[model samples]
Target: MEESKPMLRLKRTLTKGNLWLYILSELKRGRVYAYGLSKKIEKEFGWSHGLITSYVVLYKLENEGLISSEFEGRRKYYKITKKGSEELRKAKRYLQQLLNKL
Candidate 1:
């Protein structure tokens, strides 16, 4: 069954809002390419926001110094930096606080 437009929009809104946190959490596990990040998120969280969005977020994260990337042969693998880990911790705390309030 197909989801309605409103539900689809809701999903995209929620996923896009928190993609950075998801990426950082996954990268904490190990380095992965942009595509791998998308797959992992889908497998774990059941959210597939699209591959291009992943690349766009990755580029932004790299620029912000939350993550670092390296080219291994031809593939670019990304790993979360210490700053990213710290940010993830903060984000988790904020989320927990929000949940507790509700």
Candidate 2:
């Protein structure tokens, strides 16, 4: 019997490479609601993931303390926290260094 390699879909989905960076960039602009963020990402980068995915990422980021959110009517508005900004800076620098190596 042959052994099978484990699939790594979660890593790919979560990392999402530069798409995650772009999401951070958009969040840095100001507090944005989920639909707005999704639209911005789609318009700016042509990323067209489902609305649930955007909300899930936002939830994860907030849970990680990288971002903060407030309730507005029936919607939740999200903004980058200080820690999120710091992480964004670090990520940008890391990406730049990686690009330079390439």
Candidate 3:
């Protein structure tokens, strides 16, 4: 029997750790919806995950006060909150420091 590698495990980890960062980055561009976020991630990362993942991340971020959302018709439009901006700044700083060490 052949062993199978767990596909998306690494991606899932990266997404879990960096999901907020990704959402913040997207919001920095402008207000966006879950579907838009999913498409952006797919285009930028080349992964084909569904919109639910993005919605879940957005929901968590909203609950954590990292982001805010408003209902526009049937869709929820999201924006990075002040806390989200700070989180993005911290993540960017950390990433920069790590890259500098490399």
Per-candidate clashes, comma-separated = 0, 0, 0
Tens digit of lDDT per residue, candidate 1, span 33-92?
Answer: 988899999899887778988998899999999999999988999999999999999999
> Which candidate would rank higher by lDDT, 2 or 3?
3
RMSD list, candidates in order: 2.3, 6.0, 3.6
Question: Weakest 10 consecutive residues, lDDT, candidate 3?
Answer: 2-11
Model 2, position 44, has a per-residue lDDT of: 78
| Top candidate (TM-score) | 1
Off by over 4 Å in 2: 1-19
Residue-by-residue lDDT tens digits, candidate 3, 31-58: 8889888788778766656567777888
Q: What is candidate 3's TM-score against the reference? A: 0.79
Order the candidate numbers by lDDT, best to worst: 1, 3, 2
Query: lDDT of each model, Cα atoms only?
Result: 0.91, 0.78, 0.81
Off by over 4 Å in 1: 1-11
